[model samples]
Target: MMNEIDLTKVDLEKPFMAGLMDGMPGGFFVYRGDETKKIIYANQKLLDIFDCDTWDEFVELTGGTFIGMVYARDRMIVHDYVRRARESGRTSGVTNYRIHTKKGVFKYVQNYANFVNDYVEGGLVYVFIAAARSTHDRLTGLPSMLNFLD
Candidate 1:
C-alpha cells in the first residue's frame, strides 16, 4: 500500500483519491498547503460523519487558505504537531478531539499517523484522521456536553 502513495504530484487540490477509496474503513485524509487547510480526501465514513456529499463543495466552503483547521485556540497545536510530524517522519494519534466539518458541524475526529510521502502522488507525509461524530457536542465542539451547556 505504501508503494502506491505518490509524493511528487503535490496536487493539494485532489491528491491520493485512489488509495483512500481502496483503503476502506480507514481514515485517509489530505490537506492542501498554505493553509485554509482545505480537506482533500476523507473516505466515505468521514463524509458521513461530517454530513457532506462532495469534496469539491468542501473545498469551496473551506477554501485552501489557512494553515490549519480547528478553532483558533487549537490551531497552534495542530500546526505544530503536523509540522513536527513532517520533519521527523513521526506518527501519532489524538483521542477525543472535537473538529469542525464543512457544514459547520463539529465531530469527534481522532487523527493518527505520519507516513512521509514518497513524492510520486504528492503526499506531504499525510496524517490519517479517524473521526466519529456520534457523541460530539456539535455546537461547542465538545463531546456530548450539550445537555450540560444547555
Candidate 2:
C-alpha cells in the first residue's frame, strides 16, 4: 500500500504545493473562514473563470472575499449550504452556484471546499471550482437532471 501523507504537515504556501495548485486543471483558491471569507490565494484558472487578467483585478472585482465572488442572488444559498455542512461537523463540502464575472456574464460553477482549522491563520478553506455543465452528467454522459430544475 502507498504511504498516507499527513495533511497537517503540508504547507500550502510552500513552493511545491503552490506549484501543484497552479498546475491544477480547475480554478483553485484559499480563503479565510471568517464572515468576510477574505480571499488569500487564487490560481490563474480562477482568474480566467472570473475574466480577470491579473490578481489585482480579481481582488478588485471580488472585494477580496468569497461572498463577494458569488452572484448576489445565490449568496444566501451558498452560505446556507456551507453553514449547514459546518454545523453538521463536516470539514468539507461541495455545492453548485452561480458567479457573475467581471465581463458581466453569469456562470454556474461547482465548488469543492475543505476547511482546515489548524492553519496558521486560524481557520482556512481551500476550494476548487469548475464550470457546472448542465447539459450532461459528470460521471455518465447521460442528460443532466439539473438542467430541468431551477
Candidate 3:
C-alpha cells in the first residue's frame, strides 16, 4: 500500500536510523544502483546471514559491493530486475537469488527491495533498501522448495 518515499531527504547516516536498521529482522542493507552498486549500509543480521564475523571482514570479502555476493550465474538476472524496477519507478518489488556466503555456502533468499533517488555529489543516483530472508521453513529449519517457487 505504500507508494513512494523520498529517500534523498532521509538522513541515512543518522544514528537513530542506523540503530533501527540494526534491530530489524532479515538481512537489511542499502546500496547504490549505479554500476558499482556500492553498499552503503549493512546490518548485523546481514553480516550474520552472510557468515561474516565482522563488518570489516565482510567489506573486505565483497570489496564493499553487493554484486560480489551474488552467485555468478544469477548476476545478470538480478541486475536486470533492479534495472527494470528503477526504469518503471517502482518503489518496491520482490526478488529471489542465490547469494554466496562467507562460509562458502550458497543460500537462496527471498528479497524485497525499495528504490529511492538520492542526490549525491551533485548527481542523482538510485539507492536500494533491501531485505532478504532465507527461502526456508522456519519451524523445520529446512529449505522450502515451495517458498523458492513463490
Highest lDDT against the true fold, candidate: 2
Q: Write the per-residue lDDT of candidate 2 for residues 3-121, one digit (tens) a residue.
A: 99787799977887878787999999989998879998899899999999999999899899999999898899998999899899999989987788999987889999999985468
lDDT of 3 by residue, 111-132 (tens): 6676666565321223222435
| 1 versus 3: better lDDT goes to | 3
Off-target runs (Cα >4 Å) in candidate 3 are 1-15, 120-150
Which 10-residue window of candidate 3 scores lowest in summed lDDT?
121-130
Look at candidate 3 and tell me the lDDT of residue 82.
78
Query: How high is each candidate's TM-score?
Result: 0.54, 0.80, 0.70
lDDT of each: 0.54, 0.89, 0.73
Task: Sort all candidates by lDDT, best to worst.
Answer: 2, 3, 1
Best by TM-score: 2
- Checking candidate 3 for backbone clashes, the offending pairs are none
| C-alpha RMSD (angstroms) for model 1 | 7.3
